[model samples]
Target chain A: MLTNRSEVVVKKEMSLLERIYIPAILAGMRITLSHFFKRKATVNYPEVKRPFSPVYRGQHVLKRDEAGAERCTACGLCAVACPAEAITMVASERKKGEENLYREEKYASIYEINMLRCIFCGLCEDACPKEAIFLTDRIVPSTFKRGEFIYGKDKLVEKVDKRVDISKRQTQTVLEFKQNKKFAHNRLYTDKQLKEKH
Target chain B: MLAFLIYKLILVVAVFAVSLVVAMYSTYAERKIAAFLQDRLGPNRAGPFGILQPLADGVKMFMKEEIIPGTSNKWLFILGPSLAMFTACMTGVVIPWGGTLTIGDQQYPMQITDINIGILYLLGVVSIGVYGIMIGGWASNNKYSLLGAIRASSQMISYELAMGLAIIALVMHTGTLSLRDIAAMQTGWHWNIVYQPLGFLIFIVCAFAETNRAPFDLPECETELVGGYHTEYSSMKLGFYLFAEYINMFISSAVISTLYFGGYNMPFVGRFVHDPNVLAVLGSVFLFAKLFFFIFFFMWVRWTLPRFRYDQLMNLGWKILIPLALFNIALTGVLMYLGGRLH
Candidate 1:
């Protein structure tokens, strides 16, 4: 009565052939046999992986500058932005002769993100002012220990020789916004700029 | 005489080994086929294409913790799977695997035994297989197990009538009960299927039921019975039950091939391969090829169709199959009488 798609139920007797059910069974067998040769829908994981979108947020990575200096300035904005409260760190003053290791005067002496609690929302990537934290497409491999999932700088930091590409996460608009000089607070003032100002 | 006895012993061992090997691979094939039908890769780990999966499964079964229920009848519980395995392995004895292998000055039959009532013996062994399930279920002291066992026994009893009637039709035409004689009679394209197609159809349907396979596998129906009769069984005891089912499938396939599909007989092969020994080997290969096809057919039907309702299963077995089988026997009898008159 509502859609005109519903048909009336019939209680008619089946013919001899229909009653036997052999024909219908044969037809069904034919359908399944065809599917036996059809391409499988799932790939072998670990050995084969499907392509991911550029903006796909998976594991976190701590980025490095061109000079291979750690770019984080011990800011707590990412930790505050993380809804899961999975991030924790201790700030320490960068000592002399450690400029190559720490880009800023204050750096995170100990940084840890409990991967087990992090929901992979990419908020940390969004909250990073120095562009030092990024969510990459690489999956966090599973481990037995809970402590292992609490990723320290050793696990989260990008290697000097092997870099993770997060250029795709930076949209054209974001790139253009970064280029604008009107946002002076967004600019990172280097030692040369400080010297010139003094 | 001693040589003859030794030869017989070797034949027995060979048959037993071959059945066990085929049963093992049948388990692997069942999983692979189930996966393929559903558009998925099944068990490609462990070894190449999961060829070693059965071995791994056997190991896993052995390593599992064995538990015998404290409240259950220990002797009968132990006997349950043993009886199931025993009957499953016993059914292959009379199946004619090939033509007689001719040695230097001696001739040897490929089958273990060719009793005059070979078909009767098969029926007896298969019917006795129900006791295994019944005893197991009764011994388990579980309601679900009891229900499953009851269903299994009733289903087997219902289907055996139609199966017997179907085979009776085949026997009427062939005029012998010995499987070897029946198989030998179908040499060079005179396959029984040509004469008894309806009988073949009935036989196959009944075979599916007797083996407790899908659509007819109500005994171990997982949805309702909670692992059915083997719910209380664990470890290799459970493994034995599962393994016995596969062995039964293999034996049924062999029986189907022998009865209707021309066991070990390839048309016009005798013309080219004159050597008796070579012919025997070729015939054995042909029989095995047929057996594999039937085994595949069993799995194919399983994946293709959903399980039948209990009432519907009974209706088909008793109301439909029995009458049809009777009609087949009557038809065969009429044809035989007419042929005799003409001769």
Candidate 2:
């Protein structure tokens, strides 16, 4: 329990030199002088990026199959799994000719996920039996209006191939970009694309 | 007239450049000092030993947007830091950096100005230093700013008394208020610190309070006032406040050296350096070393000591320093009179 009583602890007496101002001043100076020679912790921003954890959450991207078909089958499972109720799907019958493209007999025709409401939990991917959705390592771009965050199939499709070979090449390029010049001047990704992935 | 004007221009430019450079380095030094005190490495990456950190900081400050609050007195808010920086830079004019240097047949003193009452001029300049803080705090129009200003003004005023009293005692012993005369008097092994130990101690303590250094740094108490007078300041205006602080530190160190540590005089430097030019250069180097020591001392104290409360600070100034200073003055006067009579 908390008490109003003050506890008193007796401290040891200071030496004669410590009592005087000069010695204490000298001791402090010694400390400062040592620090004067030590290394600094500042990372030169734009030029040098600090190492980020592998598990770091960034922008999100939807996955694609080997044949470049979107993994999502508009089953409304993601919509049900979404805690924020951000995902919405409109099912349409898969035509006889389009059976190879979509895994489900009924695929989502008007699928929209409100990026503002979506929690980036990968639960939509987990819920799907076809493994049709995955959150890729990307950041959502900040926006002024709530309407801009409603991501459709056009925005959610993986534009770039995430194959191992392509990822390796991209990683090297990103590393080189960080080293060769300031990050602000590097324009590998457009603002719109960054926003879509995010 | 043209030649005289050119000479004055050169002197002003030289002093301004030196003070600016010294003040910039002092910031880096303060950071490094604090880091070391806490058993941490300071800035070492900007350049070797973080020498270029100040330059980086200056560039960063310049690049930042100048923010002016809509409700503030824009004119006075702008005026405050500028005034602080200007006064701090101006104080370097009267300080004798070294003895006279002879080139061809002409002799030029290292100091910019050698007015008859140079010491008094320094005191006057230091007294006006308070106006900068006062104006800044008042102009900020914040309650914390106003309170800080009030504390700073009163603190400076209180300490100035003890400081003035200490200087008076020194003046009595030297029989002149001229800094050059006082410097010349302390020849060979006879530095004023030996004769006026008590006066030096009082003056040093008052100097700490005057500069608003740690243990006496009540004005900008971060816990209480959140950056004090410069809370609302941004960009180069904020830079000016920070820059002015270092310049004040440099000037205070220089003043301490001049009054107590014998300015630029070295025990046997005159014998080794026969040429006036060599002597002047050597004297300036020695003066710089001494000044550096005092600056380091200031930084050391800043990191070591905890700040005093408002009431405690007032009590120490009024109840302790003033009385001790008064007694020391009377004692010095009586001793000087008796010695003269005996002679």
Candidate 3:
């Protein structure tokens, strides 16, 4: 059984200075004053760019072969890979005498990808056997129209020859076909000749 | 007479320009101070650490479309912020910024207007500032706005009593109503705050309530009122309301400095600066420094404390402030009488 206790424990009284308003106000002022001297966290935009991740998705670019020919071989793999169902490709057969221009027998004559529909997934690159398409490090420029985003072959293709030259000593494996200068003559064939042979 | 009128006109324009500019910069200062407290950089992109931010803000305000509510009284809606801004600007007139600066034969007082009943004039002007809030709230035709107006009016009235009582104690001690004369009385070590510390506390709290600053900012409570009184106002009209708030802040700071902190009088400043003209300028600078300190204090408190609830604010003003002010007054009277200080 517990008995009730009447005695109360006395707490320390507030000081006269503490009870007065000035000290409390001064304390609050001190906190604000300290903050006023601290460094500002604002990053000056435009002049200072924020760090972007390595896998950041930006503009799309179509890859090219060493001979500067477009790598896309009329393959509709990109259209299937897009999650957004944004990619649309129109493939056509390579014209007569266009074998040197096109890598594959069947080339995309009117290859136009609707960029508006493209989800910018690297899955398209994974799906392509030829490794034709890729997203560049550069971000896509902002535009107003949906129609302007439909990228044609002219807009997607690499404008410059971006191949890096290797030293002759660094070439570990020399192909047997390049041993004879006569093999180079046979390699330069017209689209008709190559198609007929195939 | 024409030249004198032209000069007075110039002075009025000068004071208005200076006060408006100061208020605008004070907003920037408040933001910078808040950012500094929170360990973040404030605006610094507009022009050289965002010095032209006020200009940009002014341009933005001007460019914005003014919206008037269909059900609201348009005339009173316009009148509200105008009145607020007007009352705020008008209070600066009585503040004695510096003593007389004599150049050759002419001596000019560094004050806009010095009436005999200067302290009472300030009190009356400050009291009228409530009307702007009340009118804005009423005209907004919003339940929240009306509630805010009602709260603001009641709170202002309650605090005014304590504030008035505190002023009375100061007046009793000083035996003068003119601010210039009151300032003159506290020449060296005899500042009003030294004699009336209790009165100063009451007055400062009442000043906070009167200005609708935290923890007494129940009128424009964002959580409850959704912008409170001027909810319906937009464009430059809304800008006017914001501008008026900063101006009111500046005026309140000036009033506090003038009343308790010896206006512009600096201790032993006279000994170093022999020239009256230099002393006058220095005095004005001292007054500005004191005002700036109070302004920073206001911003500091705003960031630190949450606002008081309506009933809590009322209780603070009526139950605590008023009674305490009365007691302080009684105490001052007894002390002065016993000490034979009062003539």
Candidate that scores best on TM-score: 1
Residue-by-residue lDDT tens digits, candidate 3, A1-82: 2657666667888889876556787787787778778766666677887876555555666776777767888678777877
DockQ versus reference, model 1: 0.75
DockQ-derived CAPRI band for the predicted complex in model 3: acceptable
- Model 1: per-residue Cα lDDT at residue B343: 16
For model 2, report DockQ.
Answer: 0.20
Judging by TM-score, tell me the better candidate of 1 and 2.
Answer: 1
Interface Cα root-mean-square deviation for all models? 0.4, 3.8, 2.0
Q: After superposing candidate 1, which stretches have Cα over 4 Å from the reference?
A: A1-13, A177-198, B341-343
Worst 10 residues of 3 chain A by lDDT: A164-173
TM-score of each: 0.92, 0.71, 0.82
**Model 1: what TM-score for its first chain?**
0.79
The digit string of per-residue lDDT tens for model 2 on B1-343 reads: 7866777789889889988999999999888778776666678779888899999999999999999888788899998898888889989988888888887777778788888898788878888888888888898889888888899899999999999999988888888887888877777777898888999999999999988888788888888899887788899999998898899999999989988898888899788778878887888898899999999889888887789899988988999788989998999989878787211
Ranking by TM-score, best first?
1, 3, 2
Candidate 2 chain A, which ten residues in sequence have the lowest lDDT sum? Answer: A161-170
The TM-score obtained for chain B of candidate 1 when compared with the true chain B: 0.98
